[model samples]
Target: MSIRAVDLFCGAGGLTYGLQEAGIDVRAGFDIESECRHPYTENNSDVDFVEGDLSDDVSNAEIEEYLSAGEDDYTLIAGCAPCQPYSTMSNGNKNRTEDHEKWGLMDEFAEIVADIQPDLVTMENVPQVQKHDPYDDFCRRLAEAGYHISDRVVDCPNYGVPQQRKRMVLLASKHGRIELQDPTHDPDEVTVESEFSKHNFCELEAGETSDDDFLHNARGLSDTNKKRIRHSQPGGTWKDWPEELLLKCHKKDSGRKYIAPYGRMEWNKPAPTITTQFYNYGSGRFGHPEEDRAISVREGATLQTFPSDYSFVQSEEELSVKSVGKLIGNAVPVRLAEAIGQSLIQHIRNEDPQTQLQTV
Candidate 1:
């Protein structure tokens, strides 16, 4: 049997690319962000990119058309519904009710699964999502549809991603029981230093861009921020800065507990979680371990396990650090997605030995 897939909420084709790498014929990707079209199409040339909002009237018939387009014998519907409402960062927010609008998106995904009833289904999201009712409802719907479901919190570094991102992964199959693969990497062995050593990064100063690779550009920093980064030690926080260089917020009693900001990643350790603001010097521990600047767009993408040559934009002019950063930060780490693909393939092979799997 041949396996085919369609990625919902596919951002920059990260999940789609990984699935293709593991031998699944990803026929198309559906996402609301029109900006994602270029990267998604450019990187995964064989897959179609459909721009549409899944939460609205993007019909299940259109999705079914894509999944059934090819001659594949097996089909998979994979998605990571917008996770902001269930994100840990949104806890205790004043405007959380406004964020709840996105909570219904999982219901939209579940409805697609229940209606289409694909051979397999999978989802990835922040670990905090499981504590919420939407996640529970999604699982309940899957079980009711007669799918065998398994889900767990995954340590990204254990799956060969060189960052400290923990995500909740789910695998459900109409075939039989399914689960993610065992960890392929030792956390300590996949450090920032080891991963960076694999890439030949052009030495760039704050506000510099490499002519060779536009995505390798670094964000500019203010003079004071430059001084702060220069004083920062690997694995150390703002507490290591001199009192004169401290920000007004850091000088206050309430700010003393916020130490991860204005810090540098430890060379021998995995990096802090990559956020949409990772290009900013004061956002988490995003400073380069030795360089006096925050990590570049390429560096951030690298930490997210996007291949070094993965292009986020078609040309230099199309690049927007803020826009691309969100896409990268929000992406499922490629290696983790590959692991998920591997596990699904193994499950299929185990359930039916006659299936022939192929890799790109």
Candidate 2:
């Protein structure tokens, strides 16, 4: 009676990892990028990683082979199609049409769900995607397929993730009504003290190590940027920079409203949404609270709710800041996904007390 799951568009197995953590049997992950193969397989052993573009035709035989591999009575199909096309960040750009090719991926996901008709279905994406026509079409299709659907934009911090991120989550069940559970943490509850005070080395200086092998690394800073962060305070924006260090863009009216870049995260609060360029101090508020450099790969993974030892870059030659940054930032926060998995578990148990999932 345990649910068997196949993750579509699974990046670095964040959702798969969380599902496994929540007692679901995640059998495989499907992704287009060849880079995901190593990390996905390495982190979640025994789960097959299928590398193929979802936008193209993904045959039912391929998905069924993985899903049916397990002897479970219930099945779950989860996908978080690429959200860049429907992102508000791309809203006003004239070249938005250029991303039209990617928008069809949602439709592709819908098509698969309709064809498979799994016992349960779930999807997570940027909140902005909620307003798009494709999402509406997807929901309508699910309704037509007789799904009991529930969905809402969820704040990540509410689910115990120590980051300010908002994502739209959708849950649909053919068995019964199900919705995500209420918030586990109050908005005012997550503080710098709660997240950082445990280590004793709360104030990490640039290139400083807490002597913990896993957290011993961070992105190094240039000498000039190092001096800039020295002037930057916790939770303070780039505007706090000394007048002598002002960049050319900062003087412009358009750039004044964008203050997160080069800003330092406050220790007592949830970090800002981690992004693909998070390794660069110039991108968003990535600077370590007391350090002169941007957060390290380990710190980025930590903020994303990845376990301390979760491997993103496997080999020394494959270790590039940009590639690993994308994998971490684009990951479904593990804590949030665990909450979703817990909800599904509860829903299944409520609907059928006699049916118990087999544990791996």
Candidate 3:
């Protein structure tokens, strides 16, 4: 029999893909977004899906129903709550305390775990979740319920994702103690050319792309920003841009502290942290290495470690990709998920040699 699991707050199934790749049978997903339903269901047909709020009538009821069903030792529940409250780059429009309180949602997750008492429990979130009260409470409660919990903040690129993102992850089980997976790649890391080169990888041509392709959209840059990027060679700062193109923000004394974003990406180093709005050159250090245009949505997804065809399904044709890219940008990279899956598989195998993970 396969190891069965559920993915909560599942976006476009990036985490699901990784779990599946690591040989766990993800049986279902729960999310409130409509866009997720199409690609998620299409990509993950073997798994049933529940649409709506994680705490709403349908999601909770369906969870209970599955736990109460005839099967036992076949349940694995994983969740990732909203990270907006912990995000460093919000627009400052939403009420932080009121609108983005998903730290408390861990309570809801704990409640379901307490009720269902599934054999395995897991969650992934931003590193900031550890500082909040709710996660601490949730961990305490899960331990009391006899689930041994192991938590850590892992750097994703170290596991072969090619991006630098850190996330807090948890793995718990009713059996014995569990540990996280070890790194597949060294912390020293690979270079940009190593990650996105067209030599071994596929091409990311215009209007079409694969997640593994070196994706770039090649949009026309504004005349001024264009000149700025043209002179902004690898590893150089805004000083590379002619004096005429310097922004007022760069002119301020305080701006000196923010030079990381105004410069070109270093050819020999990992790129800066990729954000959801990475297509906007102003959002982060997302300018092309040599091209005048800011990165296209495809380019942003590459930074997120998404394979070219992980479809986002949008209406604006151009902006539609942004939604998918944002989700990809915000995702726990599939490679990281695969590492987590590998650790959990080892834990299970240590207990029961009969349990098989198709992939190690």
Query: Which number leads on TM-score?
Result: 1
Assess the local accuracy of residue 145 in candidate 2 as a C-alpha lDDT between 0 and 100. Answer: 97
Pick the winner on TM-score between candidates 1 and 2.
1
Sort order, lDDT high to low: 1, 2, 3
CA RMSD, predictions in order: 1.4, 2.3, 3.5
lDDT of 3 by residue, 8-52 (tens): 888877777778778877878877777677657776548776788
What TM-score does structure 2 among the candidates reach?
0.93
lDDT of each: 0.89, 0.82, 0.70
Output the better candidate (2/3) by TM-score: 2
Q: Model 3 clash tally?
A: 5
- For residues 1-360, what per-residue lDDT tens digits would candidate 2 score against the true structure? 578889999999899898888888888899998788888999996899888876565686789777774454788999789888877677777488456678899988998999888889999999988878899999999999999999989988898888888999999999889999899888676654465553333345566545554343566677889878888888887777788888888899998888888988888789999888887787888888776778777777877888877887765556776788888888998988988898888888888887766655
The sequence of per-residue lDDT tens digits that candidate 1 reaches over residues 1-360 is 567889999988889888888888888899999888988999885888888888675889999998774465789999899888888787768489345788888999999999999999999999988988889999999999999999999889999888888999999999998989899988889989988989999889999998888988888999999999998999998877889999898879999899989899989999999998899888899999998889999999998888999988888888788999999988888989999999899999998887676644
Who wins the lDDT comparison? Answer: 1
What TM-score, computed on C-alpha atoms, does each candidate reach? 0.97, 0.93, 0.87
